[model samples]
Target: MPAEKKAYPLRISATVLEAMQRWSDDELRSVNAQIEYVLREALRKSGRLKAGMAKPMVDDKPDT
Candidate 1:
């Protein structure tokens, strides 16, 4: 079974939120998803996450 994601309430300045929102739109990801992606990238760069640990599970869904 895959590990479940935990939710946390985050507080950030409006300016940062606005910037993140724009980046998220550009990346075609929800703001929450983009934030996770950024954090994951940083962790990988810092060597906190191993290559295997950084790989998110791919869900196979049929095209409509």
Candidate 2:
């Protein structure tokens, strides 16, 4: 089963939001997803999140 997601309000600069939008578009991901992906990577890199604890960014196969 997919994990549950929580809604949180975020305040960001317009400049940063624009950049993230472009990056997310380029990667074919929603801005929210891109942000989470970045945060997850950063956490893993900093040893705050375990490697095995991170969820896969994409599924191996399409669900039918």
Candidate 3:
């Protein structure tokens, strides 16, 4: 079975949102996924991604 999706609320700058939308479009990912990717990368860079924690899988399809 496929994994269920979860919703998160976040606040970002207008420029950041615009950049994310572009990035997500280029990468064939949703805006939310792009944001999550950036957040996870930041967390990992700061040594916050635990070995035992599951990684996220973003769907290629955008929100309906």
> TM-score-based ranking, best first?
1, 2, 3
The 10-residue segment of model 3 with minimum total lDDT is: 51-60
Model 2 regions lying over 4 Å from their true place: 56-64
Tell me the tens digit of each residue's lDDT in model 2 across 5-49: 788999999999999999987877778888888889899889999
Rank all candidate structures by their lDDT, best first, as comma-separated numbers: 2, 1, 3
Candidate 1 vs. true structure, TM-score: 0.82
List the pairs of residues colliding in candidate 3: none
C-alpha local distance difference test of each model = 0.79, 0.80, 0.76
How many backbone overlaps does candidate 1 show?
0
Model 2 — which ten-residue stretch has the worst lDDT? 55-64
Tell me the deviation in Å of residue 40 in model 3. Answer: 0.8
**TM-score, candidate number 2:** 0.81
The local lDDT score (0 to 100) that residue 21 gets in candidate 3 is: 98
* Better by lDDT, candidate 3 or 2: 2
- Write model 3 residue lDDT over 1-64, tens digit each, in one string: 5557778678889998999999999877888877877777788778888743436664566556
Best by lDDT: 2
Give candidate 1 misplaced runs (Cα > 4 Å): 57-64
lDDT of 2 at 23: 92
